[model samples]
Target: MAMAAEEIEALITGGIPDARVEITDLAGDGDHYAARVVAESFRGMPRIKQHQAVYAALGGRMGGVLHALQLTTAVPE
Candidate 1:
């Protein structure tokens, strides 16, 4: 089954605990999502690393319950 936005957001925020995340559906399908996360944990991280960190929060659900995730991360300014 495809995941819901709330389900995905909950998993990400719950896992990170210190993130300000905004989740969006790009294609109106549960399979596609874009997330912007701002967190102190991302400080000094590279763009790729930042995205990876967010993916890590999903615990290997990237290909299944969480189909496609386009992520943008930044440290709080």
Candidate 2:
């Protein structure tokens, strides 16, 4: 099953209430997406951990409902 962009955003926001999330359906298929997430929580975190935080928000949906995700994370500027 493919995931909806709203679902993805909700999941992220659910996990990180302070997050600013932007999700794009790269293929217009719902299965492939690109996300840019910015949060104060990521300020001191490493890149890998920042990415991990976003993945954790997905709750293991990647490679299953969500086939592909190009993710970017950043601290609020």
| Tens digit per residue, CA lDDT, model 1, 1-77 | 78898888888898889999899998998899999999998888898988887888888899888889888888999
True lDDT of residue 77, candidate 2: 79
Q: On residues 1-77, what C-alpha lDDT tens digit does candidate 2 reach at each position?
A: 88899999999999989999999999998888999999999988999999998899889998898899999999987
RMSD of 1: 1.1
TM-score of each: 0.89, 0.97
On lDDT, the leading prediction is: 2
Question: Residue 3 of candidate 1: its Cα lDDT?
Answer: 88
**C-alpha lDDT (0 to 100) for residue 35 of candidate 1:** 90
Roughly what TM-score does model 2 have, to 2 decimal places? 0.97
